[model samples]
Target: MAFAWKAAGITYNRYLAIAARVVRRSLKEGPRLQAERRGEMDLRFAKWQNGKQGENKSLGEANASAMAEQAKAE
Candidate 1:
């Protein structure tokens, strides 16, 4: 069984983003501001190798770059 988003030719991440945006827009002004702030991806991640963790990097940036690479490949 194929997912609806897949049938629509949209990635799962893009579908979730659209759903989140719709939910945020449906909120009242104050709560919407809070929700928008909460949606901000200030995430950080580190690569682990040999039981050692590398320096932290922005997860958002990494994902963005990876998506760009995928787009290029496609």
Candidate 2:
């Protein structure tokens, strides 16, 4: 199966990561634990820059750190 987000350059893993974070923050104690488990998906990916592939990191850390860098850039 495919999702519209994928066509917008978003991966399924990233979509799930974002959803899991939201669910985790909104759920109650018992359900929160289960949602946190859903958030535990660790994934690796690569990026090309100037035709060279960059090293990989966990999906969450990669996106968070990238946002942090962009915030610093602005």
Candidate 3:
């Protein structure tokens, strides 16, 4: 029964229109959507760099203070 249906091309053009519409929609949205996504990633990276710099500065200060305390004790 399944082989008979396959021989008749039962599903050959079943979803052709739907597949075309999907392709068109993706072509329409691809560039603009990708640009927006890239912009979002750039903004996230900027924020991360800012936070990393702040943390590094804080750590440096803490280390310097600890070193100063050690020197005073010695």
- TM-scores, each model vs. reference: 0.60, 0.41, 0.24
lDDT of 3 by residue, 2-69 (tens): 65445766664545544544555565567756644543311111224545633223445566789999
Task: Tell me the lDDT of model 2 at 51.
Answer: 94
lDDT of every model, 2 decimals: 0.95, 0.82, 0.53
After superposition, the stretches of candidate 1 with alpha carbons farther than 4 Å from their true spots are: 11-14, 63-74
**Residue pairs whose backbone atoms clash in candidate 1:** none
Q: Lowest summed-lDDT stretch of 10 residues in model 1?
A: 36-45
Clashes of each: 0, 0, 0
List the candidates ranked by TM-score, beginning with the highest: 1, 2, 3
- Best TM-score among the predictions, by candidate number: 1
lDDT (Cα, tens digit) per residue for candidate 1, span 19-61 = 9999998999999999999887787999999999999999988
Cα RMSDs, all models: 3.9, 6.4, 20.9
